[model samples]
Target: MTRLDTLSARGRDFLGSTHAIMAGAMTWVSERNLVSAISNAGGFGVIACGAMPPHILDAEIAATKALTDRPFGVNLITLHPAMADLIAICGKHDVSHVVLAGGLPSGAAIEAIKATGAKLMCFAPTAALAKKLVRSGVDAIVIEGSEAGGHIGPVSTSVLAQEILPVIRDVPVFVAGGIGRGAAIAAYLEMGASGVQLGTRFAAATESVAHANFKRAFVRASARDALASVQLDPRLPVIPVRALKNAGSEAFAAKQREIANLVDAGTIGLAEGQLQIEHYWAGALRRAVVDGDIESGSLMAGQSVGMVTSVMQVAEIIDELVGEAEAALSNRAA
Candidate 1:
């Protein structure tokens, strides 16, 4: 049998795809074109419904459906003010899979998604949470680490996989973070992961609508160049966002320091100060992705950005990944 045949059946069954690979949802990037392309290429594609209102999400889902009949998923930020409404929108579209990201989901949100008969997938930051999510009736869990782009956890992908994969058997766990090639996917599958998710590697796909400058930054970057945002003050509730280092990252640091100084001087309330810090990154990703302003906008990417050398069609990228994974698995068997 071929190595691709060795992939976990649970994953293939759950995703209803030819392979257990998923193109991680990237804000402003995973739109109709790219999502449909990935699905048509035999992998699962997820739409990143980041902070979009119900109407916009509805259109995006419909647009993607028009492009491909293959299965795809929608990723929703759990803390979005319109979480409930978004869940309803997914149901309206009969979305087959829903991935709740950003944070732990509220019971009402979870129940709402379950009511739609769509499989629920949530990010598991730890082994305990993985078990807890399974008990809460989530159909699957995605264990993503700090090496991933955008907001991230504190642990590394390798460590999180070791800690969670062995303990969770009730639901298939898809590992994400720092995965750039199929060899890494094969390793995780061998370690019992049902599948793998990749974001940075796909962000530069030809199908992605990200501006040429944004994709260029990713192509020129090395793993070391992808750094996580730092919180200058613990009192501030700024979540760390991983991105490529640039003038924008440095400017964010300066903005945080200014906010902290204001709070220390009693010039601004603590809550207001935190909000100011948080708002600094607002629209920054779109600035980079849409406007091609890599200097002053967030170049959100993972350490795997180094591995992305050029923009190819989504199908070509998937073919390369599957081929590499097969070679690795075959070599191991030989």
Candidate 2:
């Protein structure tokens, strides 16, 4: 096998794909077209089931399956109210992998996915959690850092890798965030990463159904344009979301303040307030991704946004990534 394949062997085998590269399950953008395209291109595609009801997710999985016979996965938000039903849909469709995101999954959720005979993957913010998830019977672990788009934790990808990779050995560990090139992939693989996940770069892919304005915005953006939101209230327990600076981002701060006030006034409890905040983000993202409302919609993107210079085909993007990784490994050997 070639250098790229060699480095990605474990992850590739686990994913049943030619490359271990996974397209990050971006909400609104990671629907049937892009997901199938990635899987057809010999990379893994994960359908983002962000707040999607069970029926919608079922149809999505079916649509994606019709488009490609290649293996792909489904990403389900752990906190989604229909988590159990979603897992059942994945089982009904026999999805090969089920990734749990948004928050730590309960044992019941883990068992439900595994009961479907699907490989289970969960995100870990710390090494402690990595070990804990492994002990909980997760088939794999994804360590996404603060530079990642959408919701994020405080640590950087490199720091998380340094802290988690050496210590977690039982299952495949995929590193994400701020990784826009093959050289970065090579570095992580050398550090024992099974593979990598990228979202922003793929968001502009020709196969992605993101609106033209959305693609254009990503094309023109720089790394600095992507900033993580701040928590306006300690009681609200907001998760920092990294996205391109826009009116919608500023609006989110105001929205948070408003929700926090509701929490203060007893109009809504913390849980209900947080749910409203989540719904607001979902709507805002759909506005940007589907409706082309760039100014007041969430342009969720990673620090890798600058590298997405143009809209490219999914196959082309995967080839370029593998090529870059090969060159990096070759240069190191030389």
Candidate 3:
């Protein structure tokens, strides 16, 4: 039997999940309600603290604790101005698993998190950074590829996961990006990932806080729908983020042209200067996720969005995925 026939015993202990799947933390989407549901369903759920205030973050953590005794994590955006406060909150709550996104946490912050005995997980784009994080004492590293939604990394998960796994034996590796089904999960495990992390799939789950329109968009999406938002000029301030290609993206591109013209004419005021992130793009996603308006809102989804057909309960989805992964392994053994 191959290594895939037996789920990695080491992988299960750190993941704290019966299913070798993790719900990727998403801003607005990964609230206490949704996070608890996934954790309770036998997968890891990470509460996203991206846009939340310190008080709100604390309350959410408390709320999640009340809902489930299962192990769950909190995602802290390392680039946020209040990152120090966020890390402090995690330590105060005894949140043992913290997923650091955006950029590497400061050495001081990393040390503080380590002091709390929490497992530090960060997104690494290059093998060098992955090694550095492990050396810095991170417990696990998530290699995010360009195919993922929200902010993505430069390398594909396929390439990065393969490169990092053989080099790093001390830490667990979780592959993120383009993972949304049992087959994908099985493939990653076969490729040597400790586990798989999924965001787009959970975003379309029944208990997701995303707007109905947002889930519908994911359901209707095809594999080709995921692409980085193309900028008309190289000087645009906002970084490229992957999203379902739709009318909202087109509108944002058009607005970008207006911003460019204003800059050329020297008529752009400091207050009026447009930030692509401040435009309806991010907030538009809020419209879709919170209100379910597909046409006017931006849809944050992964390439696997095409595979999501209908929204189901978190437990049912987790069970189905686990069953399929196990069956695939069993068949492979034969």
**TM-scores, each model vs. reference:** 0.97, 0.98, 0.92
- Indicate which candidate wins on lDDT: 2
Question: Model 1, residue 321: displacement in angstroms?
Answer: 0.5
Tens-digit lDDT track for model 2 on 261-310?
Answer: 88889999999998899888889999999999999999999999989998
Worst 10 residues of 3 by lDDT: 269-278
Which is the winner by TM-score between candidate 2 and candidate 3? 2
Worst 10 residues of 1 by lDDT: 1-10
Candidate 1 residues lying further than 4 Å off, grouped into runs, are 265-267
> Clash number for every model?
0, 0, 3
Model 1 agreement with the true structure over 1-334: per-residue lDDT tens digits: 5766667567989999888999898989999999999999999999999879999999999999999999999999987998888999999999999999988898888899999999999999999988889989899999998999988889999999999999998889999999999899899999989999999978999989999999999999999999999888888877889999999999998998898899899999999997776567767898999999999999999999989999888888889988999989989989
Better of 2 and 3 by lDDT: 2
Q: Rank the candidates by lDDT, best first.
A: 2, 1, 3
Give per-residue CA lDDT, model 3, range 1-334, as digits (tens).
3344365545667877666678899877999889999999888999988778798999999999999899899998786778788888898989979998877778987898888879889888888988899888889988888888877766787888788877877888888898777777787787778888889889988898887778877888897997787667555556567888878778778877888788778887433544534555668867777877777677777787887888888998888877777777778868
lDDT of 1 at 334: 92
